[model samples]
Target: MHVFLTTERLGLRSFTDADTDDLFALDNDPDVMRFINGGRPTSREAIREQTLPRLLRDCPCLRTRSYWAAEEKATGTFLGWFEFRPLDDHSPAVVELGYRLNKAAWGKGFATEGSRALISKGFTDLAVERVTANTMTVNAGSRRVMEKAGLSFLRKFTGDWPEAIAGSEHGEVEYELTRADWQQRR
Candidate 1:
């Protein structure tokens, strides 16, 4: 297993083709997918052919700009995933921090723990200058996680999403933490 990082209760690892089922299950949950897809489930075929291949090919630590599967250490249960990657493949200095956790892991501090760890690693170890994240304005839970992860609110803006969801009219909020700011916090 290619373990990228670990926290008190979670292990962040590179996603493999074998993680397809876990990713599918995480995406299929209505509550889990609520903010992301308006509760729509991803089809198995799409996961098998597109999502899985894309994730494996872009495993975070291996390729700089990619995703990491988050798992529970003790039970080896798949919680979800955390993304700590540059805004673009060409720019390694400014990374984006994001996470998606199973509904079962909600309210358990796993997101904050994993995210804080990533931000620390990014600024201190990966030479990341800034880290940013975004979520719909109505996603209070996610916003709270961002705040707890040391990212401060930067702006509220609209995005060009393909489909309109329930709270699309409210726009999205952005949060960020710079390396200097992180150093000050530390």
Candidate 2:
């Protein structure tokens, strides 16, 4: 497996065709899909046709895959994935950070650890000026992880969701860490 990044206990690597089954299981989990799709089941066809292609796509600015398959570094267990893609295909000035780990990995420090590593890499190596993340306002767990990773609350806004989920009424929140802010923190 081509590893892209690694934390103390987690490895982030490029997604491959072999990951179809793992992606299916992660998306099919009710708890995992709750905030994303209101616990709806994702068809395997969709994973192969849509999701996998997106995950495997290369970012023009970075000239590399932006979404990574995360796994346990030691045992190589498939955890989930992380995205640190540039918002604009041609510019590395701003990127969006995201993570989706399996239920088994929930509440573990893996999220914070991986997030911090990605942010540090973006600011120090990728020419990234800012890193941003967003989630539903009710997603306290995700928000906490963002905070722990050193991002500060930027704003709250309503997104155009085709199908509003359970906590859509409360809107969404954004958190960000600029290169300057990250440098100061260090």
Candidate 3:
């Protein structure tokens, strides 16, 4: 397995077929999927078919790639996963930073911690110029995570949301950190 980066608390490595159970468990949590699918659980088939395949493909995938399971370095427990990849069809230097951890892992700083590492990597290692993340406007927790990770508010744009949850009408908010902005933050 290709290990991409590791921080004091997380080891961000490549996903493998062996991560089936880990990924499944993460997506199975109701709260984990709340914003993603109106709390509807994700099917194993969906992870296997739709999500995993896209991540496991070769790099420069429209200028995106998946890192590894965010394992707690001390325990080797898979808290979740983090990614830095391009929003498909978008130009280079534009990447998305995302994370999905189980409910059990919430409020423990994993999201912000792992994400900060990815942002640094995006600017320094991947040579990415800008990184963005989005969440429902009401997802304060997620928004706070983005903020703590050093991203600044970029915009609030409406979209044809699939599930149209409570906050969907408020539109989705995009937070971004450019290489220059990231440098300033650092």
Clashing pairs in 1: none
Tens-digit per-residue lDDT, 157-178, candidate 1:
9998799888988999999999
How many clashes does each candidate structure show, in the order listed? 0, 0, 2
Residue ranges of candidate 1 with Cα displaced over 4 Å: 59-65
- Full ranking by TM-score: 2, 1, 3
Ranked by lDDT, the better of candidates 1 and 2 is 2
RMSD of candidate 1 to true structure, Å = 1.7
71-108 in candidate 3: lDDT tens per residue? 88889888888877776544457888889887767999
Any residue pairs clashing in model 3, and if so which? 13-68, 64-85
What TM-score number comes out for model 2? 0.98
lDDT of 2 by residue, 1-186 (tens): 678888899999999999999999999999998889999999999999999999999998887889999999989999999999999999999999999999899998989999999999888888999999999999999999999999999999999999989999999999999999999988
Indicate which candidate wins on lDDT.
2
